[model samples]
Target: MTKQLILCDCLGSQSVDRAALSHATGLPCSRVHTALCTRAIDSAAKAISDGDVVIACAQEAPRFEELAAELERPAPLCVDIRDRAGWSEDGDSTAKMSALIAEARLAPPPVKTIDVTSDGLCLIIGPARVALPAAERLADTLAVTVLLLDGTEDLPLSRRYEVITGDLKRAQGSFGNFTLRLDRLRIVEPGGRGDFSLTAPRDGAETLCDLILDLSGTTPLFPAPHKRDGYLRADPGSATAIAEAVFEIAQMVGTFEKTLFLTLEEHLCAHSRAGQVGCTRCLDICPTGAFSPAGDSVTVDPMICAGCGACSSLCPSGAIKYDAPPVAHLIARIRTLSEAFRAAGGSAPHLLVHDEDHGAEMIALSARFGRGLPADVIPLAVPALAGFGHAEILAALASGFAGVDILPSPRSERDPITYEIALAAAMGAGDRVALLDVDTPDAMSDALYAQTSSAADSATDIAPVLLMGDRRQVARLAARTLMPQQDTPVPLPVGAPYGAVLVDGDKCTLCLSCVSLCPSGALLDNPDLPQLRFQEDACLQCGICATICPESAITLEPRFDPTDAAMSQRVLNEEEPFCCIECGAAFGVKSTVEKIVATLAGKHAMFSGNGTERLIQMCDDCRIKAQYHKDNNPMASRERPRVRTTEDYFGQRRDH
Candidate 1:
């Protein structure tokens, strides 16, 4: 059965035409309710009993879920159409509401996850005054150990938690599995006759714990501290911060689901080839230090990865991809929103992309206090805003969205987001794509509303293309669709994933060094002839070929080539083959052979004779035979010595 859409007008505050939505979405709609959370809740319960119903109100989702549990039913999918579209001040929000509903109907793929278990082993590192009190609160909940930074003078003995003093040498891992190394360590020897005494200081003490509460008041133990689970940091002087950290620490003591945010294809990674570094975008962009060089490609520690998704966006080869909801599903949602909006008589729709935390809250606040989103504006809430890369922005524009506006929160890493926007803009998007860095909800609303001009009229008619294959493939398809009339390749900014490899013909010697080191098979050598061939579409702009070139003949040109010529191999440099002197068989390059002869013909003693110098132009088999038969051949031997040992001695003795 088709899922029913149960919507509310919020006490007649917003208009929702049931007929228009039903026609636009082709889903059965319930009669508009004034108060779905109170008086009309029974109707919601009846609808919930049917299963596969979409609740149009997100604010009362908890109450509805609680009611569903009471009635022994699964929670219905809730989409906030009110704040997103219905409550907007723009007249006739039916088209926007329909688009939001259509997008919600897409069932996102199940998120991949791993179970992380914390057995409540906590390590507290701070001064005694701060660590002891925090450890005391967590003693009942967790197996606590306090590492005192200052001297343990006037300290009372305690059995509830072990106390120690050490300099934390290194801390690694995350959540349930943290490995720590401490130097100059001393453990409390409580069995002494006098007050508590510690053992002699030792170096390189190793320990393991499930959690770490760092109140050292110096520096964070890990980079991107806020993203590290089970590792909490707070200022030692701030009582409130310490208290909050303790309370949070006490609750993290069980198996939790950690989403596997990225999927890696090692073979596809262009990180390195033959020890030559190619693409390091992921390694450079990962803020949490989750990625490290394993061999040629990088490996990600699932336990430590914070899932900012900057790596996935920056990865040129599609080796690492965001997988919480998958890139395919995200594109499907974008396409659905664009298609449904136009189907419902909407024109020039702009997409507002934001994360669930900051952007959703901002939209909610705007709906309640100020004018909500415009009728032509649609909101897309992503798990991580940074995951939406240039491909997605282009997809939205190609799918009929007049423009795309990304709203990043204050906490989001702006560098990756800005780069992606710049990349998208460089690919013919121009001013159609923007990053809104407004702080307040009103400011966001004002900025969105102030935009009067729509994207170029050509964008409206461009039909959405099917987004198949990997990130690079999808990007190419979208770029092609965006500018179908343009026949030439689009010039992209430097460091773009798409590009061509340029070779200097004069400098190249057909050594085939670049072809051997190319990770993407973008560079190849002709078996029959000495030639360097390149496929521009396959070139990742990784610079491995350029770096591996012995002659320094290869260079990279970053651009997007949508023509068919990019798909096929094109010869970059070629030369006539040198024939064997004896058999006329093709061997090496003619130019290389002539150069070798010119340098070694008579100048070198080994090739002083005309016959010996001819060996330089011979094939492998011909060269070997000619060298063996030469008059002064190194393999030639004198007449063999006869057996004159025993017989000659006997004859001499007889003569005597």
Candidate 2:
């Protein structure tokens, strides 16, 4: 890796210990005061020319970026050390700055872009007055079609596109190809409109459109209506909103680049097994209806996926990963921040994770209005709020951080952030991470300040223990490392990703229905014998096994097991195989065979005959052979009719 040059803006804003930053990064750094961005550009040019550098100023990022581009240097790592670090009252803690700089150097993985092409086949479904006008505005750019919700309203002044009356029954599909189903569709005659005479009336008419200008003044076609791509909705009651919708829809005609946020590993999913449905964790929690069950697997529509990563966080198996930055990259930031802070002669690290979009604004607001974030509280910006979970939180605690918190923007429904806090609370480290609803800068400053004050209450401080693997693997390692901190993990709340698998052994028949349906391989069945085994650590608590068990023999006990035994395989149930009476071959479950024999022997007509009852216990081959011989036995058969056929015909002719 190319070493980074840390340039602090001590001359412009506040002083940062250059020596501490150098020690933490183990790289040469140039601390410039007045001429970093302007006249005294020698240090910056020299550093950038030397290979690469880390600039500690976000305010002048554009200027530095331009300079780097002019010099043909790889994008220099630009971090907001001003609002994020220098402006803090926590004093010149260069170690935390170094940590942030280190994280910025680890470039985000290159994203694969998917092109969503739109042909501008726009549909305006709303009132005649607004829908007609909106369609007319977009007609030049888009192939517009207007559907008036109520022809009862006055007829349009003029119709540029085809004006029709219809009720929008349902709508689905993504950009460039949206499927709309309309009912009682009819064309309106524009000329001499006396009550708007309808020409052709059609039922259940369907159309394909690239964009939907929903001036309908009704419920949106998709959930999270605004988030749906290519569907621009505005109230028909508002003229301004309608104009905005029309303006926005016009520009959506050509191909656009959308990042493929979540990567789906279908084989790793526990969504279904052998036609039985198992985990629907991702489905239940996905804010957008991006995920839907596709037979044994689930499909994630990247077009609709807003990249919140709630599905990825809730997924028990690491089937879905947040590729925007990945969990590993974010988790590694926690380690870097804590380790670097301690090494740089700083104490009591209170890590604060914030979403770049929501938290950035709030951080800026707090710095401008209220007291800036406490120096002890390290701000770690992530791709999405839902990207981090219990594993990351546990890792923070294990990484010697005294406290941790996440600033969640206002949400109607609680996200995985709160759920993660609950999971860690079970481990007696709930105080380590909190979901702070910080709207104003003052609220954010106060929250971090309070957290830092309480950080001393936590007696068991942890050191950074690095572990790398999939979500489940890292979660287990973090759990095991943090287990000694608590007496026992508390029972988790509803919808928690971690829990124990419960079996109703009395109802279980060694059928292995739940075992076969388990996607995480947590439930195992021995083919050599009739038995079921469970590995708790591997279980995502997706409840797919329980949901799939036909006999209702499986149930999930939502609890945190921070012990080694949780991951160990243990036999849940076992039964002996039934041996055939004649061949001595093991075929079926002994209990099942015995139960069948008890239910049918001597009671049914077929089983009541001599030696017939024994047939039930006989192997399939033995039974077939016995039946064959019985039918072929000459002594037990009646006289043959073939020999008398000619004689019988002559005797009948004589009698007649």
Candidate 3:
């Protein structure tokens, strides 16, 4: 059923062309309502009761949701057309509005989540003055334990919470399951004591808690401490900070839904092969220590992962994928927006990719106060802006967008974004993709408006490509579309995922060690001959094959080969096969066998014997048989001893 779009003019603040939007979006857009949340709320209620409606007002979404709940119906999908498009200072936002509506109509992927239950056990770490006060605030709501840094303070008579003196050695885990180790630990002995006296100090004392309130006024226990859910930290000297931390800590009890941000395909991981490290991009860039090496592949602790998505963006093999909404869904949104914009007579549309929190707020603020976004600019809200890697950027460009400008929030990781932009530029995007590091709404608007024209003239004419593959495949398709005229291979940055393997034939020796250890099957050996074959497109540029190569002949060249030759296997090195001396069957490489003969035939004592040098040139079966029959062979049988045991024993007994 076609969804009904409830359009609102927000009391005549912004213009809305119902007829034009309906024509462009192919949806039943109602007449513009001046007051959808006030006098005309009955219409919204009727639409909700009827089912399958899209409310075009995001500002009043809560009221509409409440109405739906009251009417015993599902909450309608909300799209903020006002803040994103209608209120734009640049005139004629009809095309932008259509694109926004069309993109919002697409079904969102279901979010995967795990239920985490916190039993309200809180650990407070700081001096007695800070820890005791914070513990008192949370004692009623949570089971509190105060770990006092200074034991010199006078003790309180009332035991509202357990008090202990210790130095926190280490802290691990996340929100609902924190594991802590303390050294020089001492527990307060309350019985028959005028003043609290601590027991004997001990080391390596371990405890578990559901949450931690750090008032130690020192370094945080976890990296990226703000990203940790149940861990709260505050300065001991600041009473306001302590109060805020205590209040936040009090509410963090009971069951909560945690998003499983990533999914791992173990077979596709290029982390390691045969104990040799292939790729450590995820481990290197992960802001939180969520990834750990597990045998050949890496394992992610979803509980500890803050979902910065640096790992997913840098992952070469799509082994670790951001799952809040999969990469395909994001691509689909980009395609839909681009196609819809073009259909509505929009040319040279630019994508403004930003995170949900910072980006959304900026757009809303710009529309309400400052000059709104330009008509040609379409805003795309992603869960993690860092996850918008080079492939996604290329995909937007190839799907008819003239350029892509990423707006990263203060919390977003900058290194990965910079690297992805650099990579995308190397693969034909050039200056078409960029990072907009604006602080405020006015700055964001100014930066976007400054780029009045499309990044490239060719971008407007390039036909869009269907993005239906993994990251690499999508990237290749986009690259081909972007650089249709260029026949030469594009040179990529040093650590690019796409590349070719260079082998020095003089040193390779047809050893085939690299082929065996290649995780992506990019390197292979020919069964018929001593050959090293490689498919350039299949190579991950992981450097595992080079690391495992015994001859140290293998090296990597980072470049994107767009031609068909990249898809097919080509010989890197080949040698004529050596024939067996006895059976004439091919076995090893001719040059390798001759080299062995030259090195050891006359000098080695074992090979100096008669017919022994010939053994080196023969096949395995022939060599084994020859060795069994050779003089003084270890396999030669000895003469058996006479067995007259019974007769000899009887003769000895008679003599006795």
Candidate 4:
């Protein structure tokens, strides 16, 4: 059943802070301000329902116009406790103070009463039941010499205060609701000067009212999905059922105004940076551009958002917190578990082994090496081959686990830079780390066997091992060879080997060793079939696929073949070439420049360094101008055809 989601927040010194409220409701502070600034246009009677109260905690006052509109239908009450001058016109003044004092005390005209000055203590509370305790604290502070004498009751009780007559006479009314009517009340002057009588409030109710009216007590609330309270229940189906359930649990709840689900335009503008107004990252990458910006806030077009959870995962500022478990919840779990795994196993030279193909090698390593060199070798297992790389690894870093051994198959389309980052992280934590290059099962098994033998013979310092290898098929081989009696293949999830390239059927041979070379989990093999799923999204298109495709079966499909724009540049030449510049000097490989220009030129326009840093050294001008012309302005030189000639090949001056 669809439940009515009520977002509630109390405006008092306790709980309900601004950040917590924003995080809980997934609404921007500005929008919340808009609601507050307009004042609660709708009445509590109109905005409340039997089953739902979506109490959105506002950073500022609610917009009166918008509140009235929200109140028209569902009667969603917008409560605005005047935090920080709802309008700002109510400044501190004496006339207003005298009027408020007269009203609250019910005293006759201009009766002078001074504070029996002791310490100017303040206590604040809200109308809610939880606020009474805070109110009582204020009474205690005011009665410095006097003590609080009351039973364990929720209601207010009478109390008396000790004061000095001389100090009380000096105190005078400063503003509305602030009065200095009593003269002999100052018990002990606050730690300041003796002459000045001005100070903050010292009464119980007045203290709370002052805090409430000034918006000082307003706090952001972070109401985690209260599963026990039934605020958030398991899905039963329609929105109606969910709403009904929520109403039953939280009576007198105020539902969200339908306008909260803003238009696509509104959502975009609100979410983007101020200067980059109308930026639509959600629209561009979101499978469904179901989000838009409203003013300075982004809102979800609930109908189109599909609750896919992608927007939440990719959002830079975490503006869009999702309710789904697939991404956000999984990400949190991965981080938590990865940390536990690392802490429990990070001592010895450890490798974080992944990939199903290396199951045999891991088993051999376990039998031969034993518990991974007597250290932690975290085997992050997953159902899908590439699923673990998305956010699990990231979470591991966040959880204080810096070192990781990436073990991928040679044939798997793994990226080295990805592993470099992991290695960097490990290095950052001062851990001995290594990316074990074992893509194929056989290679991995052999490598482990060799390592085991070497480890036994030598007294060498075995560095902390971060094994990144693919041990899928090797594990099967080990299971079959080592244990002939056993019928099942070793579970691939447990330190399975993977390769750079994998072949399903005879379309391609699983002979490529690129997977083993991959330092990161950029590429992984599918354990079920001989199939290989290239996470092209993760692949930098480094031509490692073409470099290690042993069978010549895998080719960098041209534009027409793949038809995907992201793969367009993958069609460039995979091989390098030696070219003679001006005086017959082989300046390095020509294809290297071509590759760099193709892949990174347009994308990394802002990179101050030249692409020549990786492979070869281009002439100073070529390197500098290459970035300026190609990266800085690809379209600027449309008049000149980008033609390759002898001079261009030789890195010499070309005729205009």
Q: Give stretches of model 4 more than 4 Å off.
A: 1-275, 278-314, 321-375, 381-402, 405-656
**Candidate 1 lDDT by residue in tens digits, 1-656:** 68899989999999999999999989899999999999998899999997678998989999989988998988888888899998777889989888988888787799889999999999999988889989888999999999988878956566899998888989999999999999989888878587888899999999999999999888898998999999999999999999999999999999999999989999989999889998999889888999999788999998888888899888988999999888988999998998899999998899999998989999999989998888888999999788899999988888888899999998898999999898888776778889999999999888888873434565577776677777778878887878777678778878889899898999999999888888889999988888889998889899988888888998888888777888999999999999897998888899999999999999999888656788898999998998888777789899689878988999999999
- Write one digit per residue (lDDT tens) for candidate 3, span 543-627: 9988998899999999998888899999999999999989999989999999999998878998996868988999999999999
Give the Cα lDDT of each candidate.
0.89, 0.76, 0.91, 0.32
Query: What is the TM-score of each predicted model, taking all chains together?
Result: 0.94, 0.86, 0.95, 0.20
lDDT of 2 by residue, 64-93 (tens): 888888888876777877677777766676
Ranking of models by lDDT: 3, 1, 2, 4
- Candidate with best lDDT: 3
Name the lDDT value of residue 581 in candidate 2. 88
What C-alpha lDDT does candidate 3 achieve relative to the native structure? 0.91
Whichever of 1 and 4 has more TM-score, that candidate is 1
True-structure RMSD for candidate 4: 32.0
Number of the candidate with higher lDDT, 2 or 4: 2
Q: Point to the candidate with the largest TM-score.
A: 3
TM-score of 3: 0.95
C-alpha RMSD for every candidate: 4.3, 6.0, 3.8, 32.0
Tell me the tens digit of each residue's lDDT in model 4 across 1-656: 12222222223222233443333333332223223223432332233423333333333224423444555634333322222112112222112111111122221122122222213332121232323433333443332222112222222332332212222222112111223333222233334533323233343211211111111122311112221111123232344543443334223122221111212223312232333332244554454445555645666545333333334333322344433223333334334333333332222222254554454345434433332222222344332222233133333433333344456544332443243334233212223234566544344445543443343211112222222212211112212222223332222121111212223334344432544432222345543323344533233223445455566565432110111332222222122333433233344345545556567654664432654343233554454555556644654664676878877776664442
Which scores higher on TM-score, 2 or 4? 2
lDDT at residue 314 of model 3 (Cα atoms): 89
